[model samples]
Target: MRDYPLENRGAFPPHVAAGAGASISLAPVKGGFVIHLLGDAKSDEAALKKALAKIAPELGADVRKSAPNQWFWVGDADVSSDRLTEIQAGLPSQFALADQTHGRVRMRLSGPSSRTVLAKGTMVDLSADLFAIGQSAMTQIGHIGAMITRIEDDSFELIVLRSFAGSLWDELNHMAAEFR
Candidate 1:
């Protein structure tokens, strides 16, 4: 019999390069948690939000709407199994939770040129007046599907499938090259 050991690795290299003068910085948001929440037809956004706040107040996770009655609860800390179970059990009967911590990868793209780089690939209006802070759009960057959320005026967080993270990262680097 053979025994195998597993190791955790990030989607990008340890020291990923950024554009010249850091005009556009890109880095993997490793070691965090991504929880997908789905609500039934009878469950509305307001009800789900209220229930989640009452149930998992300690999580401090940023909630991003991915679709109607669907949201992704993201945080910068890894959640424990016991905590996850508690959250799952606390959800209302109309809501369900799926742990996507290991299934998805998050990347932070910031600096003044972040929007310019993203505009090259996605059609979402990155204008401040249109897509204000906390606004999230599930769209495609090049050929990769991702959730782009404006975390700040010059910063965006991208959540993509783990398998496609590397591809998306490479594409972002290329898109940001002209700024270098």
Candidate 2:
């Protein structure tokens, strides 16, 4: 009998260097968790957020709005199954939780020219004033569906399906070539 062993790997390369002193850079944000939270029709963002804070005070996850009653809770630490179960059990009866850590991948596109590079693929206005820090938008980048979050004045995080990560990474790299 033949045995097959599978190794864990990231969706794309660890890091892509734009160039020397490049004005734009792209990198995969691995080893973290992505949890999808859905609130009942009666629950509002404020109520959900308040409830979430009580249930997972130490999780330190960034709650990014995906829709009116939906949000993606993301963090840079890996969560154990026991901990996940605890969170689920603590949730209010009006909310549902689904772990999407493996199904979704995150990418960080940063630097002075990051917005300019992203503009080539997305229609969302990347202007600082319009898309201020901490704001998130679920939009299309080229043909891939992604959630773009402004994490800083010159940095953005893009969350995409694991399968589409490579294509999106390539497209972003191409768009940033001029600045490299």
Best by TM-score: 2
What's the lDDT for candidate 1?
0.85
Model 2 misplaced stretches (Cα beyond 4 Å)? 1-8
Clashing pairs in 1: none
lDDT (C-alpha, whole model) for all candidates? 0.85, 0.86
Estimated TM-score for each candidate: 0.90, 0.92
Predicted candidate 1: what Cα RMSD to the true structure? 3.7
Q: Model 1 segments beyond 4 Å from truth?
A: 1-7, 17-20
Error of 1 at 16 (Å): 3.5
Report the number of backbone clashes for model 2. 0
lDDT tens per residue, model 2, 1-180: 102222347999556466778898888887878999988778777776777788887777479999988999999877776778788898888888888887899999999999998898899998988999989999999999999999999999999999999999888988988988
Q: Candidate 2's C-alpha lDDT?
A: 0.86
Per-residue error (Å), model 1, residue 156: 0.2
